[model samples]
Target chain A: MVDVSQASGAEGPAISMRSRLSPYALPIFLIALIAVSGIVSPAFLSTSNISNMLLQVAPLGIVVIGQAFVIILRGLDLSVSSVMATAAVIATGFSGQNSDVLSILLIAVGIGIATGLVNGWLVTKRSVSPFLATLATMIVLQGFRFAYTQGAPSGNVPPLFRLIGSATWHGVPYNMMLLVVLAIVFGVVLAKSRFGREVYITGGSPTTARLLGINADRVTIIGYVISGALAAIAGLVLSGYVGIVDNWVGRGFELDSIVAAVMGGISLSGGQGGILGGLFGAAILVVVFNAVLLFGLPVQLQIIIKGMVIVLAAAFYVRRRI
Target chain B: MTALAPIRLSSRLRANQGVLVVAALLVILLIFGAFISDRFRTTSNILNIFEQSTGLALVSLGQTLAILTGGIDLSVGSMISLLSTLTSGLIAGKVSMVLPVAIGILLLGLLIGICNGLLIIWLRVHPLIVTLGMSAVLQGIVLLYSLGPAGSVPPSFNFLAYGKVLGLPIGAVFILVLFLLVALFLRYARLGRYIYAVGDDEVGARLMGLPRARVMLTVYGFSGFCCGLTAIYLTSRFSVGQPYTGLNYTLASITPVVVGGTLLSGGKGGVFGTLLGVYLVSLINNVLNFMDVSTHYQLIAQGLIVIAAVSIYVEKKKRV
Candidate 1:
């Protein structure tokens, strides 16, 4: 008997109620899980357990921020892992004492921007669909990484850079803080700025925004560039942590980011979501992954579970999509 | 009027596709081949190109179908991996090659196709997410089955991949059969028209009473079936089943599908064009190999070509 529109309007309160309560759900679940683990072993919530959890979440969280931006524009960047791998290798290659670390970082970021330029150029100017174009970029970049690395990664990070991965400042890891700062910056950009409004407008209705002369192409390009740059930053973080460069350094990162975005209540169709949603989603994913390890699951089984979570996230979004 | 004329002209710049770019690249490649190497023009080399393209050709054909429906299949590569893994392991375990291969491959295809369809339809998930999840699931299953590297296909199986009849590779025959079947279905069948109709405008198709879900389900299912067939030859040709073998095809398959004149937005291209696209990509790979260019450079070039092809398509579509 409830009209659909009326029902949707009513959904606001319901969703807010759900949102307010949902944060506690995961934490509660984690605590319960910890209690169970404690029952099994007194060391379940030990320092190493928490550090390991943070370590796994840090790299994925950095990439997910980039993923969040692109998804907000109703686009995808499938090349994040490849970008990470390529950037990581590039970063590692410049690890010598005499090597210009700053220049290498710039060059690595430049590589990402270049990739983004191609990706954005095709999508905006060439009219390639975001899905296919990004996917192609991903493959090519992956291949490029493999070719450049010659399937063997020998470069090591300089000690200073390695500290970013292994060292913590004021009892917090630099990478984790990097993620927190990015979350705030992204939060403001999407929620406060003129560019952010343009993003929402462009995503909601590109043609309508065009009629208003919002420069849809430019906005889109900026969004993708941000994604690419952030992904490169993610590579930098990963390089600092992993110590050694490998060809597959960022493998399957695109999926992880997408999953995080969806979990954060950012609709895949675009123009809906906040930084909080994205961050929360990333937290949830990391927690679940930690849950898997804490629960003693095998690696292959973990992969399968992650895949299931992705599908379930999509399914959840579809059900709640307005 | 003159100043306005350019604006009008610019709007017309977006053509439906820039297939001509690929055609030009094809010509350039041929010219390069002629200039660089004599073996390029030989019958055997050309035959070898056709033979080499079989797996990709099949996958591209499936990609074309998926793209036509305004969707994609990330699961195809995973499907290939699973089929290759299962086929090799089963064969190695002394399972009869003939019946087991046929039934096992078909059943997996159906299962995968149905799983994809059901998830997409009933759960209302995007094709990308569903297939991506399916890809991981398939990878898990394949890994579970093989547990590691599986045995190579019996040499006799390779005959389908390596054999020739009257100076033609059997792969050429398989390609021909697949093309004809696809061509016939798309050209003369009710389902075929329905596919194009749905691709053009799903809402319009629905208004016209097309079975949109059915068509989508069928196309995806058929894509999975083709993966099975492709896997049969893959095991034969490679002589081994690799858990990671099919990952590269995810992108390589799309190059041909996009190059074949299909719109990634869906409902605008067909298998014949995909066949041509496949041939073009196949030829490029072979020519690159013949020229002795390092594979790394070849990959970079291939990536550039993909961007160029899609960019051209986008430009052409805007013109139209």
Candidate 2:
């Protein structure tokens, strides 16, 4: 069984003194993967291949940031994948061949916010468990996307939006930049903000939080809403990357995000984890997929490997928690 | 006496079957069916509903057991897919129909259920995460084995599916048998009581030294076994093993389990309630089809029904 690493206090100077070495384990795994791949292909370390890895991981990284928040609140949101799909569809629809770009962008953001709010309300007000509620939402939204687009996906992302996925400004891709920005925002929120502390309290022990006058339900709802919003943004970047919108956009994304979050050392039972840890987890996942491709493993085998990693990560997380 | 009566009423409410909500929904759909088309009232259409509901009901029983232990088995769908493919593929391979099919399904189920249990218990992980991963792994394995759908059911199996027994479809008989077995186990078995105790509170059960690990393993194992059984029957009914089959089983299974009044948190509900829930869901779907509502509206309606059922569960619990 895995052991929980050293802990940082709930606040203040105690946090910085705690070693940031938790991410070291994940990075070592990545290096090992890279090393193994290099031995096989000799071209695994090429600049282009490395960039490809980052690009592939960026969409999932963004979504994992949201997943971290929800899990930290001791809740899970299964709707992020569908929220991503809905957002991508809406964004693509508005980004018609001829349109004012700004208005379309606004609509996309608005739709994302609205989706998050609905998910938040259902879980908070209706008292539905996050699991079942989000699942229903996910299916319903998927149905909507499928119905709207029929079998074929229509519309392309605008050139501007696509740039974020494709362009490299000063040799750094826009998606990578977005990831960095999200990381900083999430770091500040989780480490410095009052709301973040409240989230932890809620997840650590809901009954205690309620006793302490904390609105645990509200915090939980907020956590999911944040996750939903982040997933929407991730969808925007994803659609940009692909240059097209499809009904199946972000299919099984929730699974990926959960895997990333768990592997990154974010506990599934919630209350203790960092956003950067999740990003590293996402990186490790993408690298594994890349290595599999490099080795020419069949897609089915690749799925099996991915599934194995997910189970391993979760198993480790649970052991560490206990 | 009045206060005592209210207390008894509350207990009954707490222990009450979730079938009524499902039944009420079915009646509503029936009226809608009558209003939309006269064909809905036809005997064959009703029979078709029963036949189709059979496969889902069988799988839902497995789902009910897993959920009863305060966990889920997403792999049930994938297990069904794997077993269906195996059963048909074995028959297609000119293997003995009964033995190969039985062994194949059982092996797949045992392997998957054990993995889930080991991951959750030995690995100390959440059931959802382990099962989710297992689902993917199982799906991949099925894909690897089948390569592409290539299997056919033997005539004997289909006889059980399409043939009549006591004027009831064989599929319906299978469902009834499953219900009876589950009801009996929950009522009489020591391990079954342990399952209820564990679901009510894991820590408390452990403190009581109730063989928590064994209970967990057995419940999950039982779920896997039932899933395998359901897969065989489903393949028989469809007459073709589909590699990409059971795509919808995850939701289809859960809808009945949840609507059956089993608490998602575990430690409540039973097989009989699941039977009613299964029929109610299938009946609603049938009635919707009869009304000729666009297929698009069907999912939305299903989603609404689950939400409504959970909402009622929550409200009832909140009141007590």
TM-score (0 to 1) for chain B of model 1? 0.89
Candidate 1 structure quality by residue, lDDT tens digits, A96-204: 5435678777988898888888888878887887877787788788777877778797867766667776677765777787788888888788777888877776776
Worst 10 residues of 1 chain A by lDDT: A1-10
What is the alpha-carbon lDDT of model 2 when measured against the actual structure?
0.78
lDDT of 1 by residue, B173-235 (tens): 879887989889999999998988987887788888889889888988888888888887788
On residues A1-322, what C-alpha lDDT tens digit does candidate 2 reach at each position? 1111222343345333333556577778778877888888876788888877778788899999999988887777788888887778876776454364576656656665666676677666776667787888777777777777775777778787688877777767889999899989988998678787777777766676788788977887778778877888888888888877778788878888988888898877767788988888888888878877777877788678778888887766553431
Backbone clash tally (model 2): 0
Off by over 4 Å in 2: A1-21, A98-100, A319-322, B1-10, B93-95, B315-320
Docking quality of model 2: it rates as medium
Each candidate structure's TM-score, on Cα atoms with residue i matched to residue i, is 0.90, 0.92
**Positional deviation of A157 in candidate 2, in angstroms?**
2.0
Q: How far out, in Å, is residue A94 in model 1?
A: 2.0
Which consecutive 10 residues in model 1 chain B have the weakest lDDT in total?
B311-320
lDDT of 1 at A108: 80
Error of 2 at A112 (Å): 3.1
